[model samples]
Target: MSTLTTAPDPTSETAQLVRRARRHRSRRALRRTSALGLLLAAAVVVRVTLGDYTVTIPDTLRIIGGADIPGASFILMESTLPRAVAAVLAGASLAVAGGVMQDLMRNPLASPDILGISGGASTAAVFSLIVLGLSGPGVTMVAFLGALAVAAVLVGMSSGGAKGGTHALIIVGVGCSALLVALTHWVLLRADVYRLSEAMVWLTGSVAAASWTEIARLAVLAAVALPAMLLLHRQLRVMMLGDDLAAGLGVAVERHRALAMLGVVLLVAGTCAVCGPIAFVALLAGPIGRRLHRGRTRLVDIALIGALMVVVADYIGAYLVPGGGNLPVGVVTGLAGAPFLLWLIVTRTRVET
Candidate 1:
């Protein structure tokens, strides 16, 4: 019997590509979920066995799961859980923001804080505290808007240039960041002693005052923003291929960039609102995540890896020191990221030449 040959359907080809992308995402999700699980376990182990004073892992887990202990559960829920949640949310949010910035700006060094985005937020929040005497949700709202404003300015400036030169953007962003940071410092210096003390955690990127209020707010914002990023996954990937190419493929390049910038602002602002603009997670996460996943995973994967890193690092900070009180998670990440950043610059220059 003779068998007739059939032509492949064009829609089927497109559907296949879509299916492959979904499969890739699913695999990445599995890997990240597994990594996060391990991180949680490790965090618990580190917190219990070696932190402050030694407690058994089982006891720690019980404390975490809310079996009331005498004054222990109170401490864990009030202090430890908040800090842990802050670490995870800050890590994931900043990393995703950085990944988006890097892709949008076409610069490996691009980050949310790099473009004065977080600096703007920090500056605004500081102004609110010192000048307007604002607090609570008002401060957060102002910071969020400030971040968006900086992003808008950057996009406008970049659009004016004939070529979206990455170096030019970097230089401009650095200048803006420095100026805003200087202003923030000036404001802090002029403020009252108590206010300065209060702002110290923010200025230094500390999670020292992590609380349930901060956790709940950031968690909701992150939940919304993460899904938004996921929905734009394909658009972001296209944008990474360059604006001209994306435009040629019928993608509204400028519009997409604008949306992406909004995503970055939301991600970074929500994080800064809670964790006080923790440094380097935005700068380091994308590159580190790319390296960890062998450059195979998408931005979402990078975000998950970042979350795991922060959670793990926060656990170390919480438990590694001799005293019950620990350094801020931001301090630890900043220390770690600085050296890696230097290495990246050196390696990148060498490779280019």
Candidate 2:
């Protein structure tokens, strides 16, 4: 008689399946992140090398190496190079902020510009420029404080609500944003023609005039914030499963969320103060990164995707348009981002209904 074969344990079979799925996701993430990194490098090279005034790659390298290569030297060093670098920094900053907030809130719709954090910063910066006659660092400081205040209010309100999560934050944030926008309009209305013109340029979100000093400041902000964001990824993923589950797993959900929220504010405010509010980089970057990775996304992946979008858009705005007039990088992103936002709203509605 044949001995009866023991059956396979269901639990063991299930564990194997889980392990297999996880490995698949890990491999996908690695492939996608590598591809995005390559794309970003290529975008930077193209922006530097193939402009209205094309410079050879060898000459571009020489310029970076501190060679005085005539017309190429001044244009590449003073303007085009700086603009591309700033776009990368600012776009990466916006994306990380968005990725953190979206992950924390479990909502793709929770970006700074959409929720009015940028508007609050803009309102304060405009006030400083017009009423207080502040310039440079003063405006940046005011914008930072304003973003912090708005974010603090949002957290307080959301936590105070009965449900106290995505819906509450979105509702309170939209209301605050409207109020901030109105205040900005009021400030602009009161300013003289010269100040009004200056405020308008900034409000449009153009980095056409980005300076080396501003880029340096933004780069430092990124250095501090990007690592902090990556460090929180594990905590954020835990919370995404549910607050109760996260708490049970030994994660301090509320405290971590607040700290993460503060980081978002720092990133948005710094970018606003330096590059103006480049619309939709934050809103668009994380979702795209998640799709690309086909798994839980890395903050760096999201950041590189954002940098690519902005650098490419900035290049198009500066050089690709039929009209000689340069489009503001903000305008290009807004045109592209607004449609995506509408699509998200529609898609989300269908899913909810």
Predicted model with the maximum lDDT: 2
CA error at residue 167 for candidate 2, angstroms: 1.8
lDDT of 1 by residue, 139-223 (tens): 8898999898889888887673425488888888888899998899889888898898888867667665867887888889999
Candidate 2 local lDDT, 178-241, one digit each (tens): 9998999999999999999988888888777778988888899899988898898779899889
RMSD of 2: 2.4
Q: Alpha-carbon error at 178 in model 2, in Å?
A: 1.2
Each model's lDDT comes to: 0.78, 0.87
- lDDT score of residue 10 within candidate 1: 95
TM-score for predicted model 2 compared with the true structure = 0.93
Number of the top candidate by TM-score? 2
Off by over 4 Å in 2: 1-21, 160-164
lDDT of 2: 0.87
